[model samples]
Structure formats: C-alpha cells, structure tokens
Target chain A: MTQPTYDSLKVGDEIPTLTTPSVSRHTLALYCGASGDHNPIHVDLDFAKKSGLDDVIAHGMLSAGYLAQMLTNWVPQSALRSFNNRFTAMTQIGDTVSCSGKIVEKFEKDDEKFVRLELYSNTPQAQTIVAEAVLVLA
Target chain B: MIDKKHIGYNFPPVTIPVEEGRLKFLAKSLGETKAIYTDPDAAKAAGYPGLLAPPTFPFMLEIDALDLVDFMSVLGETLEKLLHGEENFNYYAPIYAGDSITVRKRITDIIDKKGGALQFVISDNTFTNQHGKIVAETRTNYVFRHQ
Candidate 1:
C-alpha cells in the first residue's frame, strides 16, 4: 500500500474507513489476557449480569486499539504524535464496529508538517466513540 | 460520594521491558498487518533500529502499579461499579523492542457527577525509556457508577 505523503494530504481529505469483524467473547478473553485488564465486567457473564449490565462488554481499550490500528495502518507508526478517544457507550459482544476519520486541519510548525483529524467509531446500534488525533509527516 | 482528597496521589513507578514476542502478540491480537511491528528486517529497512511497536502498544505495559481493587476499597467503592470512560495518549518518541521503559502514574482529578451517582477518577502517567527520555504520556478516566 502506498503511504500518503505530506503533499498529498490536505484539509477535508477522508481517511479510508476500517470495519472490524464481529467482536466475540473469545476475542474479549484474549484481550483480557493480553492487556492484563481482568475486570470481571469484561469476561464473566454472571458477574456482568449481577452488576446490572446487559452482558459482558468489550474493554474500552480494545475499541481504542482498533481505532489506533486504523490510523497506524494508513500512516507509519512513527508518524503518530497523539491519539485520544472518549468512550460514549459500551461495545457489547457480537457488535461490528466501523472506524472513520477526516483531516480537519493542516499546518506547519518548527519546520514540521502536521495533520489533525477528527476520528470516530460507531457500532451497529449507532453508539459512537469520538476521537481526535495529530500526526506528523515528512 | 467520591473523595477529592485522593487527588495528587502518586503510584510507585514500574519498569517494563518491551519484548519482541509481546509486540508481535499485540499486533496479531489487534489484527495489524504491518510488517514493521513483527519483523526486525522490515523495521530496519524502514529506518527503525529494531522491531517497531504499534501506535497503541503502550497499553500493554503494566503502568498502573497500584492495585485498583485496593485503591477502590479505600474509597469505599467496589470494582464491580467501575467503567472505563476515556483515554488519551501523547507520543513524544517511538518505542522499539528491547527498550526498558519506566512509567509513573499519579491521580490528577476526581469528579462527582449525577448527584454522586457517578464519579470519575482521572490519572496521568509518564513513560520514560532506559536513557531517561520521555517517550509518552497517557491520561485515563475511570468512572464509578453507583446503583
């Protein structure tokens, strides 16, 4: 895949959207092991139910990881200067997520080129996770 | 009600070594197809010193040295009511395999909302490499919901 050059990117350019496979219980389990975030709300169905949640939900970081993957897959890993997101809703198992972003601003500072983006992810149920990111380009 | 006194509490620092195998696992788990994240030769060809960590790889590092359960216990809250609310990361330098990074965490803010039914605990963490250069900073907010 060809990377986007600093010259090629401009304000209002849309990043290719990424749609993930359906989130599964097994995936959540693997994430629990990998992230060391063993909160029962993410793994134990009984615990989640008893706690008043509909079911075991995906870790917020897991969804954040997907959004980061979307960015790094397009730009070089080293080019990312910052990434942030607010978890607006729970990502339940069996939900498929789609991530999209658009360049909102472009500027030059200290002889370095930077692009700022407004990013977001949404589930099938219309729940959204909003994000903002800044990337440096050569 | 959330205690505002815990603000400014700092946790013990933890040093974590970035391992190549763990990097690969993280990439695979995230379904990343980047060769630089898992292939040393690909990273070298891309001008990196060694295996490259994915943008959010720092999430795998055990930076929260304080026990969440114990911390919540002191606050008279239970882990069952906790939820992740928001997260942010600022990258100052690239992290590569074989780098030992030290992380320091501090509680920066606590807010009570919804008439004390919901509380938020915000923490800021700094990551420094073996040479003592700051690599990244992360801010996280965890929400506690009371029934």
Candidate 2:
C-alpha cells in the first residue's frame, strides 16, 4: 500500500484494522525465545500458578507488536515517528486479538506534516491495549 | 516500596548486533508475513537495504541487552511481582538488520500509587547505532504490585 498523503488524511479517520490468530501457548513460547524475554510468568504454567494467576498469560509486547503491524500495514515502517501503548488488561490464551487505529491529530511540525493515531487492540473479552502512534505524511 | 534514591541511576551500556537470523525469527514468531521483514532480496526490492526491523522489535533488543531479573533486583523487587504498565518509543531512524545497537538505560522516575499498593518504575532507554546516530528511545513503566 502507498503512504497516505497529508492533504488526503483527516482527523478521526480510521485506518484498516489487523486481526491475528488465537494466543496459543506455542505462540507465547516462540515469542519468549525470539524476543529473549524469558519471563516465565508468560510461558511457565507452574510459575504462573505460584504467582497467583490461574494460568499463563500472553506477553504485552506481543499485542503491542500486533498494533505495530496494523500501523505498518497502513503506512510504511519508515513513516513511523513514535508509537506508545498502555497495557490495560492481560491477554489470555486462545484469545484472537484485533487492532484498530484512528487519526487523532494532524499538523505540521518543523516543515514536516505528521498525523497522530489513537490505537487500540482487544481480545474477545475486553480491551487489552490502548495506544498512540505518530507517522510522517508524504 | 522502591527507594527514590535509585532514580536517575544509569545502567552500564551494552551493544549487540542486529542479526538477520534473529530478525527473521522474530518476524515469524509475530506471524509477520511481509517479505520485507524476512527476505533480504524482497527487502531490497522494497527499497530497504536489508530486512527492516519490525516496529517494537527494539523491545527485543532492550531485553537482550539488559537482564530483567538483575534490573529488578536493583530495585529490591523480582520479575514475577512486576507488570508492564505502559511503553513508549520514539523513532529517529530506521533500524535495519546488520546494524550494531547500543542500549543505554536509566531510571527516570519512581513513585507510589493506590496509596502504596502499587509502585511505578519508569525507565528510559536510548538506542544508538554504531555510527553514533540515535535510532530510537523507549520509555517503559513497570507496575510493582505488592502482595
């Protein structure tokens, strides 16, 4: 997809959403190894049980990565100026996540046009992340 | 409660290479299907010199450069007791596979919330490529939930 132009975008415009498959244990383990985030709370069932959770949980970065994918799908990775997110809830196993973003602000800074997007991701149960991203417009 | 004195403490910097194999592995792990993230030839076709580091890939670099267990121990806490509250990344330049990334981290803030039931630890990490160019800056807020 081509990058969105500054004159073509409007505030409150929603970008295309991206959805991913269920959060399986296999996915979490793969992320643990690939990301080097060996936090057992995400992959070790016994550790999660000892930590007072009934079962293991997904990594927050995994969902955040999904949101990133959503933005990159809309704009090139090079267009990204900043990306931020708050992990509001835990994403559970077997939850298929959907990510969406809307343009919140558009303005010119230092002769460069930019758009700020309010981003979000949710499981079937509840919202897991609330985020914002800024992208430079072509 | 974490000691406020630790605020502004800087961690020893660590540098690691952006390996192509790891980038491909991460892309696969995230279920990323874009060839620009997994194939060098495809990336070149897309005008990228090499496989582009997917957004949030720096989190992998951050953790790989710093041991979370040792980082938490410095604050009198453990990994299991902490939860990710918030994360922010500002990009200055694109990071491609084969770049050497140097990470410098420092504790920026530590405060209590919920009347001490929860403590928030805020740290900022600056990532610079081998050319001495700042590529990205990440701020992470960790919630220490007291049992």
Candidate 3:
C-alpha cells in the first residue's frame, strides 16, 4: 500500500480493518512472557476463578497490541505520534477481535501535518477497547 | 481503600538496554510480518538504525522495569482483583535496538468511584534514552474492585 498523503485524506476516511483469529491460551501464554506481564489472572485458570472470573481473560495490553497492529498496518510506526486506549470490556478466551479506525480530523501542529483517528477493537460479545491516535502525514 | 498519601510514591529508576532479539520476539508475538521489526539489514535499508520497536512495545519495557504485582502490593491490593483500566503513550522519538533506556515512574493520582467499589490508580512514566533525551512518556490506569 502506498503511503497516504495529507491532501488525500478526509475527516471520515475509514482505515482498512484488521481481524484476528480466535484468541487462544497458547497466544495468551506467549503474550505473558513477551509482554513481561506475568499476571496470573491471564494465565492461571484457578487464579482467574479466584478473581471472580469464569475463565482466564486476555491481557488488556494484548488487545492494545492488536490495535497497534492495525495502526501500523495503515501507517509506518514512525508516523505514529500518539496512541491511547480505554479498556471497556474483557476479551475472553476464544474471542476474535476486529480492530477498526476512521480518520476523525486533520490539522497542522508545529508546521507538521497530522491526522487524528478514532480507533476501536471489538468482539462479537463487546467492544473490548476504544482508542484515539495521532499520526504524521507526509 | 484508596489513599491519597500514596499519590506521591515514586519507583526507583531502572535502566534496560534494548535488544534486537527481544524486539523480534515481541514483534513476532504480535504477529507482525514487517521486515523492519526483525531484520537489521532491512531496517537499515529502510533508514532505521536497527530493529525498530513497535508502537506498543514500551508497555513491556515499563512493566519489566517495575513489576505491576510489586506496585499493587504497595497499595495493599492483590492481583486477582486488579484490572487494567486504560493506557496512553506519546512518542517523541523512535526507539531502536542498542539504545539503553531508563524509566522513572511516579503515582500521579488515586481516585474512588462507584461508591468506593472501584478505585483507580493512575501513574505516569518517562522513558529517557542513553543520550538523556526524553523518548516517550506513558500514562497507565489500574482499577481495583472491592468485594
């Protein structure tokens, strides 16, 4: 995909969405080690039940990583100026996450052109995360 | 159970050198297929000094620098009842492999909501490269549910 130019973007342009296969325990264990977040609630089922959850849930950052993946797919990591997310719902095991984003606004700051995007990752059950990102446009 | 006195708590600084293998591992774990994240030659061809760190890669570094379980223990909270509420990052510069980064974090605020059933602990972290320049700053909110 060619890099998006500042003049070619509109306020409501929707970015191509990214969808993942159903989240699995194998993926969660990999994330735990790779992310350095050894929280038992994400890996230990007994612990999760003790936490008042039926089963282990995916790490919030892991879902955030999915959003990051979607953004990086649309733009290079270097163009990303800021990324933020609020966890609205838990992503249970076996849930597939779909991340979508739409350009919200375009502006100039410090003589650099920028675009703001409203982003979210959702499952069939709930909207797992909502995010906003700012990226530089060349 | 939220206490304002812990609002000013500061964690000791931790310095970690970025490694190419670790970056590649994290990128692969995220299912990233970009060459810039794994191959140093490809990264250099793309004008990057080394393996390029992904956007959310800093989340792991921060937690490695300061363990979240340790942080929760300081507040008298257990891991089973804690949940991540939100996360934010502002990048001022790119992070490449071989850069030694130091992180410093401090508790910024503590708030109670839902009639004291939920408590939010907000913290801010600053990451500085070896050159002593600020590279990125992150804000993280952790929520605890009182039973």
Candidates 1 and 3 compared: the better one by DockQ is 3
Docking class of 2: high
Please report, in order, the local distance difference test score of every candidate based on alpha carbons. Answer: 0.83, 0.91, 0.90
Give a tens-digit lDDT track for model 2, residues B1-147. Answer: 889999999989999999999999999999998889989999989888788998897777888888788788899888778899999999999899989999999999998998999999999999999999999999999899886
- Output DockQ, candidate 3: 0.88
Worst 10 residues of 2 chain A by lDDT: A69-78
Q: Give one digit per residue, the lDDT tens place, for model 1 in A4-106.
A: 8789988999998899999999888887766667778899999999889889999888878888888987887778988988989889899998999999999
Best by DockQ: 2
DockQ, model 2, C-alpha based: 0.91
By DockQ: ranked, best first? 2, 3, 1
- DockQ, all models: 0.70, 0.91, 0.88
Give model 1's TM-score versus the native structure: 0.93
